[model samples]
Target: MKSQSTLLVICSAVMLALSGFSFFHRNKTATVSKKPVRVSSNYRIVIDKSHYELKLYDEEGWVSTYPVVFGTSEMTDKMMEGDRRTPEGHFKIIAKKLHPEWGHFLLLDYPTQTDLEKFNTRKSQGVIPANAKPGGGIGIHATRRNEDRFVDYYYNWTLGCISTKREYAKELYDLLPVGTEVTILH
Candidate 1:
């Protein structure tokens, strides 16, 4: 019985050590600069789901790029509600606000006339169910506080929104204005 107790203690110590190491490693690798950069009024965002990157552009050219994660590993265009896929197409930043959990939230104007037309076409063709509805409230935002590991690990944990590091999301929220053009591509 003494020997068994010793082995159990050793195993517990090993597990605790491993968890600590993971925590340290995640924090070290996921750290991002919080320094603010110059904001441009002509800024536009281009999110490439295939590359897991969000690139910012101004009139001059590319400005910066931030690592991003999506809703699903399939990276397919969202079809309907609960699909858990990020949609592809042009969108605009309809609103911007502070989020209680995910930090800064930049709401996107998804389901534009183009998106509606496509959704309706798919419904008519039976590609999507007649009762299906296109989802909304999509946006780009940060992972929850102290949860930068999700972005660092490419976990893709959102319902249908783009996610970045908390610092990066704040930077984006500060730089981008309402009506900014955002394009998502595969």
Candidate 2:
């Protein structure tokens, strides 16, 4: 009877230890490297749609690169609403918010004056329907939790936003601030 009691205690302790380890492992955030480069106030971002990369830069130059996915496989400049294409041009981070599913979202100032002008030209030229509208609410954000494979596999599942892994989004959200310049290119 004493031996059975001892075995029960041992199993309980082992189960507790395993559960703790599993919790820690699941909650741990992955980093790009053992030591991440520090971001400065002069930081800027350049996203290359063709290359599926988001490169970070400071006044000093390139800091790091994060893998990213886009809204469409077309990889062209966004034409109209619901085109699923990511836009190309210079923009700025306008807002930051914590998202329930994607984790961190950095809203961009899309549909700038330049974008509007281009959109108008396209409409007049009949490249798009006269009634077509330019969409808004574009940004860079994280994939849903445990969905980092979307980025790794280049699945391109957003409506028009750029997406990275959850951890990378958190890193960017913590580092970048409003008014930071961002340039998206093909």
Candidate 3:
């Protein structure tokens, strides 16, 4: 009986030692790839459409993120004029305007070009007006005091620009500058 108990103890010790050795061996061999995360020199505007969140990233990680309302209707992609759908693509920030009188303005590069080939054959074209200019004024801006914030937060309500609360709008407009790169992703 004593010999059986001794054998069991020996077996347990051997198993534990084996486990410890294997674990250390695996960890020592594991090599973490040293690579730099690509970051742009310009400001980054990240729009996660699925999550309904807009994040601004600077030289550091995420600088700011505002919970946003998408669109009253499902916003998949933008079409012709008055489509009411916010565009999703890469754009360049050309201008920035602030209005204590109005709000804030962030001019964007719009008319990201949807099916230009089809337009020549088709009667209608998705043009941003020959004179109006494509990808113009768009930015975070303020809203009304008496307005229902819930609706804006719950649904998408901008002509094309991304609008936030007055304070947050100001924050973004102040932190980010013109010539920033903005990306709207699904």
**Model 1: lowest-lDDT 10 consecutive positions:** 21-30
Please give the CA lDDT of all the candidate structures: 0.85, 0.87, 0.57
Model 1 lDDT, residue 27, Cα: 29
> What lDDT does model 1 reach?
0.85
Candidate 2, residues 34-126, lDDT tens digits: the string is 235774799899999987888899888888888888888888999999998999999999999998877899999999999999999999999
User: Which candidate achieves the best lDDT against the true structure?
Assistant: 2
Model 3 per-residue lDDT tens digits across residues 143-177: 54443363243445665556556665666677666
RMSD of each: 5.8, 10.8, 18.7
lDDT of 2 at 51: 75
Clashing pairs counted in every model: 0, 0, 7
Off by over 4 Å in 3: 1-41, 99-102, 113-138
Task: Give the residue spans of candidate 1 off by over 4 A.
Answer: 1-36
> In candidate 1, what are the lDDT values of residues 1-186, reduced to their tens digit?
999999999998899678542221122243333323556689898999987888888887777878888888878899998898999999999999998998899999998889899999999999999999999999999998898887777777788999999888998898889999999999
Better of 1 and 3 by lDDT: 1
Candidate 3, lDDT over the whole model: 0.57
Residue 16's lDDT within candidate 2 is 68
